[model samples]
Target chain A: MPNILVVEDSPTMRQLIGFAMKRIASSRVIEATDGIDALKKLSSEKIDLILADINMPVMDGLKLVSLVRSNPAYKDIPIIIITTEGAEEDKKRALAIGANAYLPKPIQTQELIKLVNSFISQ
Target chain B: MERETSIGKKADEFLQLFRKGEEFTHEILKENERLRFKLAQLEEAIERSGDEAKIRLYEERIKFTEDELNSLKERFRQVEEENKDFAAKYVEVEDENNNLANLYVASYQLHSTLDFNEVLRIVLEIVINLIGAEKFSVLLIEEKTNELIPVGAEGISISDVPKVRFGEGIIGTAAKEGESYFSENIHNLHNRGSISTETPIVCIPLKIKEHVIGVIAIYSLLLQKEKFSNVDYELFNLLAGHAATAIFSSRLYTQSERKLTTIQSFLDMLKEKPRR
Candidate 1:
């Protein structure tokens, strides 16, 4: 029943994340090309969670997180930042700006599903 | 007077006999009371013995119940342990399944496009997303020059990458020999961004059958990738075959298209000329 929004620039990465998200029982995966496309999808659907990559074209994930946090209607939704940035500063910044969790790639799909499920089941 | 003395003595005798009878009756009553007391003590002892037997029976039942409860508790613990092991195994299997899915997706996308540039882009994406390569390039062997030229690159500029002749260096030799090279010191590198033209961490030669077409050289992996995994080796094998075919076929298709266009233009020019 949870709707997960996946925002990534690479089509292959997007497909990879989407494939993992679909394994969650009764969960619907909404794909977006980048942060801008994520925002567009956000307006149309009631997104339960957001899995976004920090490095993306058009708009990055941090900007998306900031935008989502500022908005009253979408503020409560959980956001998981998936990125290749393994630096502590990047992780701390993402959390400080309102990302619920940070996951670095190369992504373990099992871990990804478990983390999402935890947030959804909460 | 003699007769009166005789009667008084007889009376005295009768009184003495009555007193002796009264003493006998008192002794008998005392003996009966003592016997009753002994009987009461014996009955109480018997009752006490019966209560002890019941207590012993209840104690045995309680001991049995306690043992049964402990057995059940142990069984529950075992079941819980088994469930935990199953959960761990399930996670492992799921991870394996996801790895397979990555392979499937990478292979599917590689062959999905016939555009030469698109094919190169897919290869780069697979290397980045699946293989976790950070600094890498797809170099095709230039037929005329017999050199490997960078067709696609990430993390380093394509112009900066050096071209080497076939069978020259590690990468070139990999292409020439149609073999994959994985550096033993891949995990020992301190600076991941430093470009080493001669020493790439991995070089997978792309081949169509026995003909080596190109090579995918990976200089550095992502910061989080400590080493290559089994699935990564499988991906390399897959890329060696499928990516090579895709790239080769797409290049051939593009070349043939250009040749067809040029030939059509020449035919049009010939038709346009007026007969003398």
Candidate 2:
């Protein structure tokens, strides 16, 4: 089963995203509170895909994306930015930094499921 | 006759001797007068040289005093400049210290509680007391409705406020955009009709990670405040992250605590029941 990492600070949001990921695919869902935590997890376990939020405390999503993209080992892994920063510039910047997709918050469960499914299947 | 002639010759010789002696005495007196005149001239010259030496010494002393005075004046100017520099530096340091203290207190009060209502109250208090915001409101976004609802308010009646949907008004737009909105003159903005024109407005989004959980609407500033300063913006940014995170964390903690208590009660009930 593919191991998916969900990086979000809020516990409620993390639970919501975890639930959606489980319903869509029978994959291993790992939760991380922030980008720093996510990086620690990535080092220990194999993460196939990453879903990240933008404005976390220790390290934000953009910094995480840049770090991941710069690494030789994890550069090819797909990253999806799911954040409340829904501005056009935010989306453009995320895509420019090597994110595979940008999804705004208050996201529909089906859309998230479909997005996660598409990436894992590929 | 011969004897008379010899006596006359002797007298003539003696008269010649007396004439030579008189000539020698006149020459000696002339030489003595010349020596006295030369001694007087030498004494006058020595007195004049002594007066000249005294004048030269006084001139040197005057020059030295003037130089010392000028040096002292230069030292005074340097000291004055240093004092001005130190005063300016002290003010800057004091301002920086005050800002740091404000941030420290704000962080402390924000994290001091885990109760949702207490968090809202503390945030409001910080905005009012620390930030010097006179009129403001704290609005949380209803996740289901995606609407901004006022939870706490000051200097304005709660009834006077209108319902704002997400991305609708200034407060809603700030929450929707997940960015801060500061207007020195609210009358110039698109949503002036919704806000009071008595003072400027600043809308800050309270965000946890990327999600904007709430918005802080500042309608007016204190009388002492003329405009928003960089420090005010810093405080706004602090509120955006720290305040939001505090509220979100507290809510989650309370919810989890309740769930744990419920689970513990369930276990207790099951243990009391007959073994199955």
Clash pairs, candidate 1, are none
Badly placed stretches (over 4 Å) of model 1 are B1-20, B143-145, B208-211, B259-276
User: Per-residue lDDT tens digits of candidate 2, residues B1-276?
Assistant: 899999999888888878777777777777778878888888999999999999999999999999999999999999999999999998687566556655666777788889988888778767765565667888888889878888888667766665579997777788899999888564433332355622327889999889999888888654434455566777788999999999889889999999999999999998896977
Error of model 2, residue B81, in angstroms = 2.0
What are the per-residue Cα lDDT tens digits for candidate 1 across B153-201? Answer: 9988898788989999999999999999998886663346477967888
Each candidate's fnat: 0.70, 0.00
Model 1 TM-score, 2 decimals: 0.87
Give the Cα-based TM-score of candidate 2 against the true structure. 0.58
lDDT for model 1 comes to: 0.91
Best by TM-score: 1
The TM-scores that each candidate's chain B achieves against the reference are 0.85, 0.80
Worst 10 residues of 1 chain A by lDDT: A104-113
- Local accuracy of candidate 2 as per-residue lDDT tens digits, A35-98: 8999999999999999998978999999999999999989988999987655688899999999
